[model samples]
Target chain A: MITTIIIYTLLAGCLIASWVMSREKTIKASKMALKVLVKTMPSLLAVLGLVGLTLGILSPQTISSLIGTEAGPLGTIIAAVLGAITLIPSLVAFPLAGSLLRAGASVMTISAFVTTLVMVGVVTAPMEIAYLGRRFTLLRNLLSFAAAFLIALLMGVIL
Target chain B: MKTIKRYLPIIIIGLAFIALAIWDPEKADASLTVSRDYLKEMILIIPPVFLLMGLLEVWIPKDKIRSWLGAGSGVKGALISVLLGTLPTGPLYIAFPMAASLLGKGAKVSNMILFLGAWAALKIPQLVVEMKFLGPEFTAVRFTLTLIVLVIIGQIMERAFTGRHEVLWEQPGESVGQKTKQMGTKR
Candidate 1:
């Protein structure tokens, strides 16, 4: 409810701002904005759909079972690697990670996954390349994946 | 041919999702329902985001951002990038395009990497959720540890990769938004 309210308020502000700004040259600005909106909508919709489905299908318990185990060193490594590969949006990943933490998933695994989920995106490669250049995007992701693994390993060792 | 090349991967991914849905209709339906719930939130969320992004694009000078965030930048700059990223609300999708735009304008690879890392690793909203669901200690520990890792990784990337050489920025006249504009103009 709060989030919704915040979003609505922001939307109202944006509408007002756009309206005021558009008054200077209403038709041209409106047309340009609409044009940009139409082009990006499909890709944006597709990404949102994928994120939604992934969240829907994977239960906290299931996610926990797969990578949340405290199977000593091996489990931590698996968790880290899996975390690197999987991409979860922030809105869902944190709550889910918190749930897994409650359900006995190691803090290390949850941390690693959350880190990698944001840092590395194996799935969004195409969209990323389209927006960010391919070489920069790919290298950054690869480095992030490695860093997630290292963090998990260190967390496993320390915590 | 260009269109096919551009959309091929998305098409493949979509087909894969369809296949998964067909393979288990029950699971697919459940997923779709959950996705719809999230989508509703996203729709509500996205419009303001679009406007904010537009405003930022207009207001923030790219050169100033680049000097601080550009390749081979200082530790202070990298830290600043990370801090800015950690404070932001919303998902990586919102960040991705913005980061890409910055990259086009001369944002450093290390800064972008740090931005992506910190954005996902340390979200204030997610932190609140973590504190509520888990505990303060756990959230604090995780945040600190992730911050440490992101910084260390940023340093490593700086060392290993020559950011100067990498094609970090977008080429002239090739923005995703620009492409869309051209398409619209044509129509």
Candidate 2:
């Protein structure tokens, strides 16, 4: 919330400064902003809705049990799915994952959780596609999904 | 038809929510709450970010981007990408537009991947929190692994997905179109 305020203030200051420097450029710039907003609106709403549904269905308790039930590849896959689908902030995610780790979850499971949580963003795909187009967004997510899985296995072994 | 197709994702999700409400109101309520909260954050943050990206397109020279992050940039470009990504910028989604603009301005696909990877998996503040909660060893291990894998992934993507791209916010009079912007291939 504070971040939002600071960003808005910074944005306002920058807009003002730009307007003072070049009214034409500022207008041109904001015109593009409007275009982008219009182009990306449906995707943005979809992201929000998907995030809500995923998080609602997979409560923290449910997530813990799914990731904690098994110590093998299955658990890691479950964790990865949970991470990819849900957009948990690092602040909340770290503590929850850490507690799960202490509560007998395998290092691989937690690694998969943390890695996919950051690397793969299924819920945010709509927004990604809006900006980056379908090909780049799909490739990035698929590749990151593979990388996250591999990294989890390595972390499980080494740590 | 195109309009409905564009809105299909949200429409499907909306139906899912309605079904959940009918079958189990409690779960539906929880989902709506989470969605509402996230919507608030998105609405608050997106405007400024988009405005900044617009300003960036106007202010930053295309050649500068080409030289700094293009194919010829090599190792230095990766370093710069990581540095740019690690800063406490906004969420991962915000980076998507910025990355696209940079790519349009001739950023290497590999470097952009590094940038996105660093932004997503390795933000500085997020690392601090990870170290505090998960201990230094765990943090150190994961960070190193993530960075290494990201570099590898970036290199692979650089090779695999090289082609023309659609530049959305081109100059004012120009409509959106595919730009055959092969970064540094001419050189």
Candidate 3:
């Protein structure tokens, strides 16, 4: 909700500014936007499809069951892997993490899940690479993945 | 063959959908529903985001961007990068183009790295959700640790990628040489 409002507000502001400055530039910008959209369409569509398939097959119940039953260190690893690959919205993911925590999932496991869920983007890598280049995407994601584990470990100790 | 190579991922996804439909219709329907929801969200967000990017690309001069967020901007530049990043926005994928834009305009790799990291992990709304679900203790600890990690990661990546910026798929309207020059590519 806030995201929508902020984005639309920024877009409207920029569009109006561009229009007032020069109609030609505004038009060119619009065309550039369209070209980028088209260029990235394949990867976008691919990511959407993959996210749907993953979420559809691995229902929340299934995820909880898998995470809830496993032991600590191994469970945290699985959670991290699942979080890295999956693209659950934070709204949905947080409550799920809370529940998992209450249901005996370790702080470490839930932290790993939440951290990687936000930081890493195995599913969105194609779109990321398309926009930011392969090496940038690879380094960012790999480093974030490593950082997520460190965060999880520290969180496990502290809280 | 070129077209095939380009769309191969989409094609594979299509085949996967077909396979799911044949093997388990209910699962396929569920997947389609999720995809529909995602598509709707993307449709609402992507156009405006891209347009805003377009405007940024056109209206914001490279020098202006460099002065504000570039290599010499230092600590203040990094703060601005985080501020720009933490705006309530769409997914992490949306940040990639913006980050690329910043890069093309001479933003420090470290600042851009910070931008991407903050955008991914430290948005205000996301933090609230984290606090709500995980408690202040967990949230605060992770937030602090993540910030430290991001700064360290940023510095390392900046040093590693110091002069190697030649990559395919040029931004619209900029010549390859111009881009190479702006990014300080050795070649």
Correct interface contacts retained, every candidate: 0.40, 0.74, 0.75
Q: Which runs in model 1 stand beyond 4 Å of their true positions?
A: A1-42, A68-70, A85-107, B67-76, B132-134, B156-187
Cα lDDT tens digits, model 3, B62-177, are 88988898778989999998898887557887888888767876788899888988899998888899899888888888889988999999998999788666333355767867
Q: How well does candidate 2 reproduce the true complex, by DockQ?
A: 0.77
lDDT of 2 at A98: 93
TM-score of chain A of each: 0.65, 0.95, 0.93
lDDT string for model 1 (A86-157, tens) is: 555555566777777677777667667766766677655545654565665677788777777776666656
Q: How high is the lDDT of residue B13 in model 3?
A: 92
| Model 3: pairs clashing at backbone N, Cα or C within 3 Å | none
Best candidate (score: TM-score): 2
- Residue A139, model 1: Cα distance from true site in angstroms: 2.0
Ranking by TM-score: 2, 3, 1
lDDT of 3 by residue, A80-112 (tens): 888888888888998899999988899899989
Better of 1 and 3 by lDDT: 3
Q: Give the Cα error of residue A107 in candidate 1, in Å.
A: 4.2
Clashes of 3: 0
Candidates ranked, most accurate by lDDT first? 2, 3, 1
Provide per-model DockQ scores.
0.43, 0.77, 0.72
Error of 2 at B31 (Å): 0.6
Q: Give the alpha carbon lDDT tens digit for every residue of B1-187 in model 2.
A: 9999999998999999999999989989999999999888888899898898888888788889988998789889889999999986578988998898898788888999999999999999899999988989999999999999998988787777776565555767654542453333443
Steric clash pairs (candidate 1): B70-B108, B71-B108
